[model samples]
Target: MRSHGGRVRAIITGEAHIHADKVAAITGCLVPFPNYPAHIPMQRVDYICVVDEIGDPAKIATGAAKPTTDQRKLLMAEYCTQVVANTPYFKDGLSYQTGVGGLTKPMGNLF
Candidate 1:
């Protein structure tokens, strides 16, 4: 992560080792967000990949898994917000970036 003229930028990436090439391709396909106005410019991205994964509900769902405690969730959100607030890159004109997911959505709300 870095900031240039108040625009915060990040390149989020992940890697996985899988036995099946098709799975890898599928997984890569799912990594990128659909293009939208809020998306950072494509020029900022150094690289990208598209992959696929099994989406069967039975295979993905965990029955009776305990939910995260409200307190823990609050803490995580606060911690994420605080990290951004404390960073030098944060300022009156901060441009935040984060993964599009449950925790990150809350963090963005806090920001």
Candidate 2:
């Protein structure tokens, strides 16, 4: 954002994110609040807005992370469980991530 000359950010303090923290820290990108003092040396932010609400993150994530209910997919999860459990690679301390997929989360549940 700094290399782009300036960037605009709409902030809702209730859902502050780590990426925003890094940007604010590195470039002091925040605009001063209505009654607060300026807190930047070189402002990379063209505009900063404080909004009341974005959405309920928990509700959004719950909807997005929902697993598959299809019978075929559920059977696939069962097959995956059987196959993986029989494999040498499925030993203790096996590490995996359940990222961005409906099937993946259900597969994890089976094991």
| Best candidate, TM-score | 2
lDDT measured at residue 63 in model 1 versus the true structure, 0 to 100: 36
Predicted candidate 1 versus true structure: per-residue lDDT over 1-111, tens digit per residue: 234422322222223322323321223333346555534465555544543544655543343322233677768988979987898988875666766344665676678
Candidate 2: Cα lDDT at 10:
22
> Which digits, one per residue and each the tens of the lDDT, describe model 2 over residues 1-111?
222222222223433333443233322243455524434433544444445565555665566566778889889878978898899898876775666466777888887
Candidate 2: Cα lDDT at 110: 80
| RMSD of candidates 1 onward, in order | 12.0, 14.7
Clash totals for all models, in order?
10, 0
Lowest lDDT sum, 10 consecutive residues, model 2, at 1-10
